[model samples]
Structures are given as structure tokens and as C-alpha cells.
Target: MNKKLFLLLLTVCAFQFSFAQKNLLTDFPKGYTPEEVGKRLAYRFLEGKHMLHGGKWISYPETFNWNGALQFAAKTNDKELVKLLQDRFEPLFSTEKALLPIKNHVDLNMFGSLPLTLYQITKEKRYYELGMPYADTQWEVPEQAKPAQKDWSKKGYSWQTRLWIDDMYMITIVQTQAFKVTRELKYLDRAAKEMVLYLDELQRPNGLFYHAPDVPFYWGRGNGWMAAGMTELLRCLPKDHQDRPRIMQGYQTMMKSLKNYQMPGGMWNQLIDEKDYWAETSGSAMFTYAFITGVKHGWLDAKEYAPAARKAWMALVSYINDKGDVTEVCVGTNKKNDKQYYYDRPRHVGDYHGQAPYLWCTSALLEKDTK
Candidate 1:
């Protein structure tokens, strides 16, 4: 009688422990590891015919969406995913009308280098040739990133640049890609300096950069651009270069600040540090990608940061609908000094901005080192 009762008690205890573990696992999405969820999000977003903005078939930001999937494919050597991205990009080769000419602002075609990347993979000259004009334009510094002083090019440089944090990616991603194609030191240096100057102006004492020095909103997507851009640049920047440490310092600082603001649910607010602001997916995805990459490279303490980053990835996955659309992304925003403006900005599901960052987060999480 005593032996039978003891066995029954042990069985009940085991069942209780199993139930509690399931509850703890709720922080992540069910039936998917971080890698699986990210890949699912990428494939889902790709299934849509109009993943681009304004119903334009393809645009600069959408290229990042494709490029992120491509990077993921490249890292995992997922041949099927690689083919899918190439097929998606095939329509661009059909016509030249959507491709921005060099006369346009370089930022207008921020992902112009995607063709160059495609060329490398497919050995198709047309893709490479299409990117040449865009590559050449990187040498032309826009007035936006140029310092305001007439002597801006002279001996002592000041941080009085008109650059918004968004330019960090818009300018550098294009330049870094050009460097990859040309092996030109100038492109690499230009990308690095763009980051250093922007950090000088926009990085606050708390380690987070502002949306703009004038605006100071720390708008979620704006900071997403910065984190995503810097991470991209660091991947290509020369290790021995002078600007590497400075940029790393800024990146580390930004990560530190972002760590403090992440919500328990794994999202950052539309206004970052503001508690009342709505949590956003695009920014959280960007931060997760950056942080996980940082941990992979030893830039972040993996023990402390990885868990939080994994949580953020889970929260990000929760935003994806069955259709692969990311929800709660802030729509395009203009510079504003008012905090309320950021808080009240409209959010839309399946926007190109959201899709691009989600791909990036998925790709980053899938990297071998992140495991």
C-alpha cells in the first residue's frame, strides 16, 4: 500500500513540472525555434506579390528585403531560398525605368547595390553593369551628409552635418556594397567616416542616437536604420582601420542603451525610452539583429544579451500574421521635435519598412555564430 502511494505522488509531481516548463516557454512562439520562426517570416513575406511600398513593384527598401533573404541563403547555403530571391529580383532586369539614375539623390536608391550582389552570385553581367552608375555615385557626397561650414573639407572638421540617423544605412550600405565590388579603399573609408561623423552628432550620452540632432525623438525605425546600418558596415569595415574602434564604440554604446529600454514582451517602444509609447516590431527586429550579431562577434556579452535578444526575436515573430505581414510598424515619419508626434504616428501592417527589418532579423538570427 505504501509503495503504490509513493509512485502515484511522483507521477503527479512530474506532470506539474512539465506544465510549468511549458508556461515558461511561452516567451517564444510555439513550434518554432528562433531560426525557424525567422525563416518562416522571410518565406511568408516573399510569397506576397506586392511586398514593395506604394504598390510599386520594387523599390530601394524592398531590395533590402530581398538582400536579407539572399544573405540568409548565402549563410546557410540554402539553394532553394537563393533561387527564390533571384526569381523575385528577375522582374527588375525586365525594365530599367524603376532604377534611379545617378543624377538622383544617392539615398533614393539606397539598396542599388543589390544588383551588384546579384551579379556576383549569378555571374550575370547585366546585374553588375546596372549597378555601376549607382556605385560611381557613392563618390559624390550629398549636401545632406556634408558639413554646413564652407570650409567643411578643410583641416579641422566639425560634426555640424545635416545627416539624419537614417542616412547611416542609406549612404553606407550602398558604399559598402560598392567596396565589395571594386575593392576600393575609398568606399570603405567613406562608409566608416559617415558612421563616425553621425555618431559624433547624434549619439547621446545614454548610448542611443537621436532621430536627428534637431529632432531628438529617438523614433524607433530611425534608430533601426542606425543599428542595422552600423551592423552592416562593421561586417565589411577593415579591422585595422582607424575608424573601426570609434564605430565599434558607438555601436556598443547604442546596444547598451537599447538593452535598458527593451520591454518585457521583447519590443522597444515607438519612442524608445518612453514607457507609454506603443511597442514596435521594426525597431525591435533591428535591435535583435544587431545585438545577436554583436554577441556572435564578441562585441556583446552573450550571457547577458543573448537571452534578451532571443526574446525580442520571439516577440517579433508574434507580429507576423499567417500571411507573413509584420504588424505594429510605424509608417514613414518626418523629423519632428514633438514627442507626441512619434507616439501618435500611424502604424500599418505589411509595410516595406517592416518587411525589410524582419528579413534582416531573421537572417541575423539564422547565422551559425548566433547559435
Candidate 2:
């Protein structure tokens, strides 16, 4: 072949390969870009006066939004956004200390994730001092723990282990945040071990999880918790980590199941396996987050998963109202055995449960984000 022709052919081949590799971040339409969507969501989160629905102390949904907003701020290097979020935490030092959650339950302890994120960005000692204890206490066995809880603790699990699907994200995020900042192996190890056990006990043969064993319903956000939890864990879990294989397997399995259920409009149903159920925003966003992270990290096949992720993102953006609140989010729910309990849950607009995961998906889509 002629030298010039050969060089041109190689250049064309390289270009084709580059296009073949899915870019989950860009190729978005106006108002749906990660930067725009993330800023809108972060500012909206900061502007809100209250995140706790009626609880005296801040709960997981609110903390989850705070943590995600902080990450978005840090990723975008939005100094103003970071400062605003940090200032919100100021009252916990004194005036609103009572509003701070206690270290007893997984949901409460997960509040540590927000301050720890602030610590990572600002290197502030106050945030570190307040946050580390919550992560640590999660592993510390309590005297009042039941026999089964005691057995879980004997094997180094938290006494708070209730085998609920929601517990995985609540348990995983705080520990993952600790590990990310402290470079501590114990936090990662504990989360990984707990994740593996959850996979064994709760993950059904179909790769979807029941809200709990007795519930036997694949509630979307319940599975969303497991999906997002595994994605967060795998992001930090080392390639050679002992539990990596099992965690990866569970993540992949759930993702495949999730992929099959993604609607043509890219939203997932409130009951993931029930096509007749309503399209849900929070769970849909959460699943999109997992898909985006998995594709970005090379844990999932990019060509197949990236489009699904992109479609979900675009579809989620359509759900956001003029006020930046995510629509059709299922209200905070507890596990009930009856399928009707899940089907009948009210969907709210702008609920923190719905708003939180959108920032997560946006952050995952940012090209420069290596975290």
C-alpha cells in the first residue's frame, strides 16, 4: 500500500474506535448537560430551608442529598456552592446540635457521610472529628444487640444489621466516605463483607432483591439502594480486594436485571418487575447512577450500558420541573409484605429521596471526575 494511504487508513480506524467507545458524559441536549443539571440541583438543594420531612433529626434522604450535593460541588469546583453547603453544617456545632442524628441506627450514622465529604474537600478538622466516630461506631457491637445481631457482630458486622435492602446504602456510604478520606482498609473491608452477606441473603435468583425476604416484592428504590450501594463500594474497592469478585458479581447481576426493565422512555417502574406500576423518579435516577458509574469504571460493557444510562439521564431531566424538583418520587417507605403496600405508595414531587440521586448521576457523568 502507498505510505500516505496506509497512514490515513490507520487514522480513520482510530477515529472509529474512539466513537465506538461510549461516552456516558456528553452528547446531551440543552438544559440536560451534566454541568447545568448538577448546578441547578445543587443550588436547589442549598436553597431549601428544610430537608427533613418531619423527623427531629436529619435522616438518610436529606443527608444523601447533602452528601451528593457536596460531591457535585467538589467535582465542579464550585467554590460558592461548597461554602454554602458547609455553612449549613455550621449549626450542628452548637445551635442545632440536637438536630444531628445519633450513632445508633444505620440511617442516622450515615449522616457522617456529608461532613466527611466536606472534610475531603476542605481538609477541615472539625468535619473530620465529627464524622469519623459515626463510621467507627457502626462496627462497634452494642450490649443491647439481639442474638442474631450479636452473631453478625461476632463475625465483624455492625450490630445494626437488619438485612433490609435500604441498610446497604446507609451502611456503605458512610464507610466508603471514611475509607476514601482516611485511607483506612477496615472501613472498606467492613462494607465489602457486609455487601457480600447482603448479596447472599437478599439477592434473588433473578438478580433483583425483595424489599426483605418476607416481602417478596422487587420494590424499585429498595433495589436502587442495593444498586447504588454496590456501585459506591466497587468504585473504592481495590481490583485485588478479596471480596471484589463477589461484589462485582452481585452488581453485574442486578445491573443486567435492571437493564432489562428500563422502559422505552428510560424510567424504571416503582415495582421493577411490574410493568403496570408507575414510573418512579428516585429509583430510576438511582439505577441510572449505577449504570453510569459502572460504564465509566469499565466494570460494565460501555457500548451496551452507556446508551441505557444516557437515555435514563435524558429521561430523568424531563421529569425535573421548572423548579428543579424531581417529579414522581415515591415517598419514604417501610417494608410491608403486601404488594399493594408498595403499589399504593404516594409519589411526591421535589422530595429529597427523588432529588438526591440526580446529583449523583450528574457527578458520575462529569468527564474530569476521577473520584
Candidate 3:
């Protein structure tokens, strides 16, 4: 072969080899295993102990980070890590009433799942014991409460009577966990009913659920929460339950629409509809986790969804920097009016928000059952 042609072929092969290594579905990269990635994130949480904001730390929406750490600990079986979680988390319990101070449905959902995770790891009833009252109260919210109105508080947040896809994760998944812990059929029943309500009320004509009905936004991460939440809820829900089919149908409908929005690079943008929307990493990671988990657990068809999951995983890995930090995560936002509102959101690299989903997606993708 001519020297020029030989060099060109070598370059092409090298590029393909490099790409394959970075692609999580095709091959596991040498430097960062799922466990290592998870540990690094856990370490960050440890270092930032007091600085971590949200339910487990401060009472912020992003406090959902604790759930991510708990997931990593359970999957990796790192007892010391689990102990650290218990230490940090136990203090957050409200001693006055002996109940978690979950003021809103969203916090109730995020922190509510933690006790169940603690129970899973330690099998200690105390972890889940405190959550009982709150779990019981959640069932009391009328199945048909008018959708929440969208009125931003002084802190640039809004609430509405209607369900948003985000609430599925923020609330329903935790409710499902509570059901699993207590084995109370009511918890599952209420979760299923609420999930169906969101599906019925918020799902757009295009098959994707709107981010918020009152706000009329359809952000990708918002939908990611719904997809992941449903997958988690389904894992614990009974197979023969009547509500199972409805939930599955909702997932299938959303997956169909998601397939169309996937970019050539694999990541979805903040605004999934606009071609110019820059691909986002956090939402992409969550979607990949939910889709891959669904396929593995038989909730979704592997042959059909795996390709999309793989593509999103590949794009997600590309966002990881040399230091093993995941980047380009879109910042948290309230409901918005137009595509530009989503597109203009700032992006950050190596944020804990992004790291959680990265760990989740990698773990889900690399699971032997999925392959």
C-alpha cells in the first residue's frame, strides 16, 4: 500500500479504537469503573458534608444527592461508605416529632426514599421506622387534588396543582420504596394512582409528558425524572397489578418520542425540540439509566431501546473530563415559557448533580444482565 494510504488507515483505526473504549455500552474503559466513579462521588459528598444542601443536608430540591450516594453504596456494597451515609443522614431526622421534616411533596419524595435504601443496606427497621408517619400521610392527599398552580416563590420557585414529570421522581418513587419497606398495599396503590394522574394530565400529544402542565414546559431533565422514577417504581410494583399496564404504556409512549429527539452525538439538549439546543449530560445520563434499567428488568424491549440507550451513554461519557469529572450539566431551573428559556440555561462541569446520574448510567449500562 502507498505510505499515505497506510497512515490514513492507521489514523482511522486509532480513532475507532479510542471511541470504542469511551463508549460504555460497547466496552468498559480501564481508568474509571462504575465502582470507582461512584466512590469518587461519595468522597465528594463526605468532604462537603455540611456544605451539601437539601433534605439530607439542607432542605433544598437538589438534596436528592443523598439518594444517589445511597444507591452507589448499595450497588457497590461498601459498608464503610454506608456507615458514613447513616451518620450524616441520621441527624437530619426530626427528633421533635420523630418524623422527617418533609414539608412539601417533593422533599417528602426525595428523603422518603432514603430510609428505604437504608433498610435495604442495613436491614435495620429504625432507618425505615421514622418514615412511616410521613408515608401514611402521603396517601391522604386526595387522589384528585387539583393540579398545583405555578406561582414562583421569592426564591424563584413555583408550585402547581397539576403534576409535572419531575414530581414522579421527587415523590412517587419514594412512595414506592415506602411500600416495599412496609409491604403495605396502600403505598403502592397510592403511588400507582398518582403516577397515572401525572400520565393522564401532563403527557403531551407527542407522547412525552410535559415538564409541567400549568407552566407548559417540556424540558429533557424533567422528563428524565419521570422516566427514571417510573422505572424505579416498576421495580418494586407487583407484576399482576392492574396499574402496572398503565404505567408501562406511559413509558412506551415516552420512549417512542425520545427516540426521535436523540441527537447524532447521543446526548439530549435542554430543549429537546430545538436543533440548536446544546446536548446536555445530566438529563442524558438519567435517560440512559432509566432506559437501560428498563430493558434489563424486562420493562422495556432490549432490542428496541438498547440502541438509544447506548447512543446516549456514549454521548454522556464524552462529557467526562480527564479528571474523571462529569461536565456540561444544565443547572436546575423552574418552569419556563419557551425553547430559548431552556437553551440559555448555564452548564457546569463536575457538579454533584451530573455525577449522580453519571454513576447511575454507568452502573446500569455495565451490568452483566444488560449486555
Candidate 4:
């Protein structure tokens, strides 16, 4: 072909390829499959907050948001976003303790997830090394004092004095990742042991795990943490390990119970069982990530669970505004035991906690079935 004709064809092909790539907020037909729409909406929400926690040029960084950005970049191959997160947060590493001083479960738990991502991206042993102290802190919990025990008072730390399902992922997922990097049996052993402890202490008779066993309430986001944690653990754990089946059962139970709680709009309420509770986007997004990742990894039956995952995704997508901003995410909270506490919780737009799940949801959806 002549040079001009060849160049024209190449340009047309490039345009078509770009158009075919799926993102956080592309419009689709009405009544499209829930998974398809959910995936699209999730991606749209994620894209909107690409530079979260930073000013137009300068940004303050938090551990959790940076962790999510790492996952999003890995999945989507958005190198610029990854570098942006690393550059902003790398300084924070200097002051980081093996365990964070923050009292909140989610905030402190973030330490476990961040270092592995840094290690993965930078191939720096220091990141992995930094994670070891946190892993050591997490793994050091006495067997008798594991979160599954009904008595929180027996635990040494003030923060860990109770059984919260969210802690399983927050603590164990990172330990497992550390094990992968360090190849230490203790990390793996401790992660598996802690997971069993949480499951034993926290699993409800209804098959869903409770938000906090010590408290009377069950929150959707707490369960989402459990589900996501299990999915992440399963991804890293050995295929032939003895705990695999038990772990799978935990995931299956969560998937089964959560489906009935899904709202018609494709979201789960703050109080998952209480229809009166407002639909929560962060929990819904986390569930979508867990379920979709479960399906991708062959832990959950795709045919049965994918629809529910898709519905949650779609409902979450509706929260994204035109500016690529994700809205209606429930803000960070410490464990609250009362129904009123969860119900009364205020929702915010583009909070850091919400950003992680937004990216996770989008990346998971894009991986499975990109339009």
C-alpha cells in the first residue's frame, strides 16, 4: 500500500481500538445485563477520582487510597496513576511504624496492604521489609486471643479487644502477601490460623459473617471486608492447603446470604438485613470486587454469583457524577454496635476509603468482561 493510504488505515484502527477499551463511566443501553452495566459504572466511578487526595498539582496522600491506586494501576496498567501514588506516599514510609497508631480498625489495618503493593511496583525489599514488622505485629497475636474468641477483653491491644470480621482481611490478607514475598511459613500459618479464628467466632447462623461479634450490629461494609479479605486470602494461599475448603465455604456462605439482601437498584443497604437502611455505595462496591474477583479466581460459581455482583456494580455506578467523581460513599467509621449508628452515618463524595473500592470494583469488572 502507498504511504498515505497505510497511515490513514493505521489511524482508523487506533481510533477503533481506543473506542473499544472499557473505562469507569461509559454509557450503555437500558436493561443491559447487570454485570455489564455494573462493570462500566464501577470503572466510571474510579476514573473520576484518579487524582484523589491531591490538589490540582500537589496532593496529600493516605495509605489506603494509595493502596487502592496500586491495585488499580496493576489491573488497568495506568502507570502515571501508580507513579503519582508512589511519589506522594513514599515519604510517609519514613514515619510508619510496624503497626499504625490509628485506633480505627480499617485505618490501622491499611498498613498490611500498602507495603506489598509498594514491593510489587518498586521491587524494593524495604517495602517488603517494612511490611515484616507489621506482619510480625499482626502474627504475634496469641492463639488464645484470636479475634474469633467471644471475649474481647482477653486481647492485649485496646483496638483488637473485640471480634470484628473486617479485621480478618485487614490483618490476615497482608500477612499472607508478606508470606508470599518472604516465603515464610509463619506468615502463612498465622494468616490461616487468624482466618479460621475469625470465621469460627464471627460466622452467623444465617451463613453471613457478622460485622462485629462483640457488638449487636451487622454492617454491610464489615461483611464486605470479610468477603474481600477471604477472596484475597484465597488468591494467595496454597491450592492444596487444608484450609482451602473451609475458606471456600466462608466465601460461599457470604455470597449466598448477601444475594437476598441486594436491593432492587443493585446495592446492599448499610444494615444488610434491614431494608430501611440506606443503600451504601462503599460496601456495595467492595462486594462487587469480592464476588467478581471470586468468579475470576474460580472460588465462586460464576453463573450464580456474577449477576448479583453485576447488580451491586450497577447500583454503585449510578453514584458517579459527570466529572468522574464518585459520590455517596459512606465515610470512615470505627465499629458501631447500634442500628441507629450505622443508619445515621453520613455519606460523602470521593472519600479515600471509597476510592479504594471504587478502583477495585472497576478493575475487577474490566478484567472479566470489557465492552
The all-Cα superposition gives candidate 2 an RMSD in Å to the true structure of 2.2
TM-score of each: 0.82, 0.95, 0.79, 0.75
Clashing residue pairs, candidate 3?
Answer: 54-58, 54-60, 147-161, 147-162, 148-160, 148-161, 148-162, 149-160, 149-161
> Compared with the true structure, what per-residue lDDT tens digits does model 4 show for residues 1-371?
99999999999997765444322223334634334433443344334433322122112124445566576666667676567666655655664232233323333544656777778777988777666665565534445554553243243222353467767767666677777777877666666666777888889877677677656676887887888778778777787877877887887887888877788888888888898878887788788888777766666655567666766667776776654456777766667567688888889876655656766665565565421
Each prediction's Cα lDDT score?
A: 0.74, 0.89, 0.68, 0.65
Q: Candidate 2 on 102-147: residue-level lDDT in tens? A: 8888888998998898899999999999999999999887777779
lDDT of 3 by residue, 305-358 (tens): 767777676567667776666788887777876767787888886666677777
Which segments of candidate 4 are over 4 A away from where they belong? Answer: 1-61, 93-109, 141-161, 368-371
Q: List the residue pairs that clash in candidate 1.
A: none
Which wins on lDDT, candidate 3 or candidate 4?
A: 3
Of the two candidates 2 and 4, the one with more favorable TM-score, higher being better, is 2
**What lDDT score is found at residue 159 in candidate 1?**
25
Backbone clash count, each prediction separately: 0, 0, 9, 5
Give the Cα error of residue 356 in candidate 1, in Å.
Answer: 1.7
In the range 188-301, model 1's lDDT, one tens digit per residue, is: 887787788889988899988788878977888889889988898888877899999999999989998899999988899998988988998888888988987887676787
Q: Which lDDT value does model 1 have at 293? A: 82
Best TM-score goes to which candidate? 2
